[model samples]
Target chain A: MSRETILASIRAALPPGQALPELDNFGLHYDDPIQQFITTAEAVGANLQSVDNRGGIAAAVQAFLPGASSILSHVPEVPCKNFTRDADRDPHAYSDLDLIVVEGLIPVAENAAIWVPDSQYDDHAAMVLTQHQVIIVRASDLVDHMHQAYAKVAAAEVPRFGFFLSGPTKTADIEQSLVLGAQGTRSLLIIMIRDESTSTI
Target chain B: MIDHAQHARNFTANAERTAWHDDALWFVREKRDKATKLIPEWEELREQASQVKMHMLSRLDHYLEEFERNATARGIQVHWAEDADAHNRIVHAILERKGVKNIVKSKSMLTEECHLNPYLAERGMDVIDTDLGERIVQMRNEPPSHLVMPAIHIKKAEIGDLFHEQLGTDAGADDPKYLTEAARQHLRPKYLEADAGITGVNFAIADTGGIVVCTNEGNADLGTSLPPIQIHCMGMEKLLPRLEHLGVFTRLLARSATGQPITTFTSHFHGPKPGGEMHVVIVNNGRSAILAKPEFRRSLSCIRCAACLNTCPIYRRSGGYSYGSVVPGPIGSVLSPAMDLEKYAALPFASTLCGSCTDVCPVKIDLHDQLLAWRKYVVKEGYLDKGKARQMKMAGKLLSSPTLYRTASFLSKGMKLVPRVLLYNKKNKWGMERELPLPAKRRFRDLYRKRPRS
Candidate 1:
């Protein structure tokens, strides 16, 4: 079915009021909220310029796409995953412009290191990320964040320890005391872009 | 009973616990990928397993009958439950016959679906969950957020607290190893003393008239091996045509569900350990309803692999409990509404329709598309609120014609003050969070006109 019909059918299928409070207009997302919520949340604010990695939105974003890896990171170490310009990406979903930057390009300074949960390989990505703000999220930490982000938005409210994931990480080798974030990034990094655009001030 | 909105709020909170939850599960997902990548037949395996499930779903009633017949010949008593209440009572009645007040249960989503423990508790029976994760959640007085990993939402520190309070651990003793030993010591006695064991069927073989239970920790083995009376609760959809399908399914099941090369254990029980009593309850709460409809028939194809749950973006953000169903996440979003639309109507809309769940599913349930179809059913039932219905009808009328749509757009964008009251309908989700952005002066088509075509 067409996106409109799929949405119409879904909207039609909802038991009314249950579709509670949706984006004013549904475009490509099939009127699904999870996408709208996450991608939009990720959109945060665009850089005033083209810079997506560091400088300005214009220069940064441009450097990150279309033979993105071909454009070297301002930081030398962080490995840049090949970037593709996904113009069709839903604003509510993670954009196609994911750049797996080298881990060590910018290291977490002593004071701010506390906030960022460490990434799995600290020493390897360490050199490239020192100057830049870094979030060392582990596989487990990402899961926790996803849980927290969904809960944070959906409830239209937030709760403490809201992002902790409980189950899959728990091992019953001896007895099953579930440990979350054990094998993952324990801290998150909020990289402060020098040239602000849409990001929180 | 909570309102759908409140339950939805709770679900959102629970589901958020899963956003990273999906990412976390992705390791296992990645692991499955790593394993699948090595083999050229990975996609083929998914197809064969899906077809097996398709055949089973189509003739669920028939295979179930065959299972009952074979199991009965093997000296097992079979019961059927039409709903949760019936399912619970069947177990209760069996326990009452055995005069057992306590029982051990191994990882059964069906029991969770039935709410068996709480139901039995009210009737004076103490139902103990034997699966390690289930045990932890039960001790904490919380529902299992994820089916396979019962205590996934619980942290080790929190578990330390739970164990400290219940099992007498030192305060702040948060070692996973130490805590597990404590639980093992605690549950061992319960395993030996329990009168009956309840296990969920991972796969039930119709030909052998046997039931299979898969687990990593071997909790199900202890539950069934020790208990004199074993009660296996299975959904009608858990059947496989022949026993050989086990090799393919067993290969994919754990790998897909938990990223393990194989679940630590896969045990098949023909019926009663020689002399013990065996009972199988094939519950069909809403399978028939879904099967009757073509769009949703494929949902029954799910192997409960949870690959969809692990990969779903919405499920990742929101943990399972937010769903307010025995099973949560993408699978529950579709099935819950199918089982009870009034109760779960909001679920389908909870998704962004990313199609990730469909992609990860080994059985290929077409979850996103079914959700799209279900949306039509919910609306066609006229269950919509009149005011919103009127609003939608008005919007529909305007959008049906381009000229009217343009006029409405121009007025909203150009007028600036169309009365937030009128332009920003507070009752809508748009107004609930942020005001809708006014339209740009020109449309994309107009912009295309300005710039030469590529």
Candidate 2:
């Protein structure tokens, strides 16, 4: 077979979705970093010190969450692992906390905002924001953020999608009327966590 | 069809476009440097971003399944499409069910991958591009040459002329603000009258079934907020593991893309509006196949920030249309081959292997390396012109063996016939536009041997 046809056949065979199969799913469900933080943070419910990756909201809760709670946070970055690590490939490579504000407890940006996790791989390494002052936001805020994002992308161009998701940029290119959110990412959520160590300040 | 062969011709032939391409990309490179150089921790951040994408890609299946379950629980319908046709059919079928012919849309590359707007238009629905730059290119019936700045290839006066012809602007009005206002006024009616809104997802959080989009223009708010039905198209690779990582990305994205401290607006989403219907389409296209290749997986880490486009020397010269896809520049080179290698056979070779693009890329994709990899693929695919193939094989054979190489080098010492027809004539793409170098009468190897034996 022609190499072109062979490659296309292989491309055709692969399944499409959000994540690759078999790499992360052993069908084994376990509490990852976010899950563990969620379990521990909710147990304390007020001011609590976290081991790592759980400070942005722990501090926010101490400051606001209905109770007079104290502050505690951990230095999120630990010692490096035993691999050949380079920080150049992926910058947002750090493992971070999942933050949430049930009653809009933390003020991040002007609106409710949640921190996004970073990526890591062979080409790029992650940049862990050490002891970062993270934001905690409401679930509702994520919805609002998505709606706005949807509109921005809908109006964008398709070819420019590589440049920042251009297909979402809504334009009257097909017709002479203005449209919104044609690209369709609906909301954003920001979770704030405060490790008790940072809260000590 | 993109009519890629023909469009590619238009892109390379336009000298003005070439100049605009250079200046436009240079401006992007400058912006990327401003973003990356600012943080002493910038290199570290790129690594983090790449690793995060890799991990997300690694666990992509689980996260997508998790997302589908959660999104469905939250009343959002999730659909899987393996290709552009499937994605378009699903979206069109959904819109047909709603009986909505007029729809407002934000930017979405997936739809472009599916050619969704045109597909819908063929069905008689009206789709509007909400972003100002998108609107400009859409109106001109031209593909955007650059990713971030859509009309970066278009001069403001040309836009004025286009608006004057299409939108009825006053004959000498060339003001950016004035023209912008005209477009806004012209498009406001669609936002209100449209029945559904379409958008593209910048980042999809599988953990929480959420999305994040950042924009300088506030058009996204106008597109989705004023519409009742919303559909979001997300490339499967656009997944993130957590929300905390957003802080790192938002800090780096706009600064790298356009030199802004941050995009004027960055929004996140979890579900539908209180009363609206929400649909999410996850598209694979060639992503799964791409992920399987260890060398090529890093291409998926692209944040769609177009920083590399700005720094690419060849891209500045040939422009985006030469690549013949919606996504252009360095990312486009990596992506196009995955989608359809034969069609984009020329794209990988378009680069000069300058590597400046890789240096400026925010996520630090080894773009030049990818381009080099593509060259091998094209040759192996048998897509290269036979004459070129023959020449390459002959050269390879000659160089790989010292005797053949020495014989060829000896033969070329006094040979004037080779240069006149082989490399310096109209038949060669390189010689078509630039001056062909005159071949030296004596070979450098022969002259060095004749010198002293030091």
Candidate 3:
């Protein structure tokens, strides 16, 4: 009954429809998108690292967070001693995780955001519950803007959920002071793999 | 009647705090300017975003139905609420059926509008606000001042005292990083223990049957991901026609909000996670009435970026609490009066009609024009105070009659000879905080008559 009432009211309030604007030329592009991505990513407080292949991710992770004790790695290239993917396990089980390494699908150069779908991991909480996060994105998978990134997302298989993660969990709530790791991941590291053949990682 | 001027006077009484607040907001506005400058197509993007919103408003019914169908097909439960009470009841009913005890909420202004936390708390449900700023305010038992930076009104030292009292932090520990870490430690358990998660919708895509929530702290994701049940409360106006529109809105949102390239997490939820339940509560709550008024309809297009609040000179100086509403800026001034004309009639007069808010609005809502329109409606509806109404009527008559205006102008030149006490007495409201300008040596009419003809 409320549904019908709301819909009727909306219809009654409707005015003559206007045309939606074309978004063909809405987004901006840089001459060097990767360089722009690095600059923007660092500005947002994300650490950037260049890895040659999937094998180098382990070394890079160790170098980035040497003291990480409890690790959760969704990427098979980077094995962890702490925990493995368990679909039925309670998400709270990953609450004490020190680091989480997952693969990013597409990286947007404009905002330095990496698209990570739910299908990439068994538990969604692992992405944000950890102290530090490492997202492995291919250099070739970088797009110029969100428009291009969304195009890729629209074309891909629809996940139940996904996100364009730009940086670590941060907040400027108290006196507009930028504080990283406010309620979630304390730090974010993007490992850009330049080797094209290492896609399966 | 809600006296905004009196409340503003209370806030401005502390001159030092007022200047600090003004400088803080101006700093954010400058950051916004710098961020937007990076994109060469920024103005065009705003135009495209505004047109898209207008188009969506025109066919709102069609899109709402489309969104409901697509979302329901994806196994997300869809519910509609005719008003705020209905919204609170629907959410409570869902949580009640699930036997949820403890709940965590992200920064959803709709819930704040509905007073959902108190409603649920009265029924013995424990509701925790998970956003750091929101948590701080919740602890202090206050409402958010600004939309984006909720705790911007409270200084670091106050927060330090609050944390020391609530979370047992060291005394005099006023560093933002330390206070934020204390909040992080305190809220993580709430997220882990929450039986349900409630979040506000940033944008809902009709074509994709999903909603996008943007946050820097990722609390929304954490709260919703672990909970067995998740509820997303959204105003009907948040609907977008397609997923591509997100590309446009997401680009403009953070740049306009906090001057970030983007919020850290732009999470998209198509439906519930595996073995988890998700519900979308679409609440009307005076929005349909707003849509019916062509003059005020564009106010519904706001994305809650708080750019208008940051750029508004009055908001900067007077602070958000002075507005006496859930939202407290130029957009709030226009929207609040429409909710209750008699109670909020004074809100429209709170601004200087500077139009800075209009220039910075991502959706290009004519905020100052709407304020002016609301003032006309307020006067026509006889909501203005009796004394002000009589003075305005007298001024109107004098301005319409050239002879009366000229006579008054001529007589007013003699006011310089009068003592300041007689001129700035209780009858002169304008002279309360301002000085009357000195009269010209000769009348403007005489000077114009003697001017050399070009």
DockQ of each: 0.02, 0.03, 0.86
lDDT, residue A139, candidate 2: 25
Model 1 alpha-carbon drift over 4 Å, by segment = A1-201, B1-32, B385-391, B409-425, B431-442, B447-454
Stretches of candidate 3 off by over 4 Å are: A195-201, B442-444
Output the number of the DockQ-best candidate.
3
On a 0 to 1 TM-score scale, where does candidate 1 land against the true structure? 0.65
State the displacement of the C-alpha of residue B340, model 1, in Å, after optimal TM-score superposition.
1.7
Compose the digit string of candidate 2's lDDT tens values, residues B1-454: 2344345567768777667657656765675575456455667666667667766766666667777776787777788887788888888999999899888787666777788888999999998887777788888877666677677777778888899999999977777756766876687667667788888888776656666666644455455554557788988888877654564566567767775445534555556655567888888777778877777878888888888777777677766776777888778988888888888877777678989878867667889999899888988888886656766777789989989988876776555556566656644555555765554777787688798875
Better of 1 and 3 by TM-score: 3
Estimate, for each residue in A23-120, the C-alpha lDDT of model 2 and write its tens digit: 11112222243443343233212122223334344443444332322111222221122223442322222222121122222222211222222211
Q: How much does each candidate deviate at the interface, measured as C-alpha RMSD after superposition?
A: 20.1, 14.4, 0.9
Model 1 is docked with a DockQ of 0.02
Model 3: how far residue B68 lies from native, Å: 0.4
**Alpha-carbon shift of residue B142 in model 2 (angstroms):** 3.0
What TM-score does model 3 achieve against the real structure?
0.98
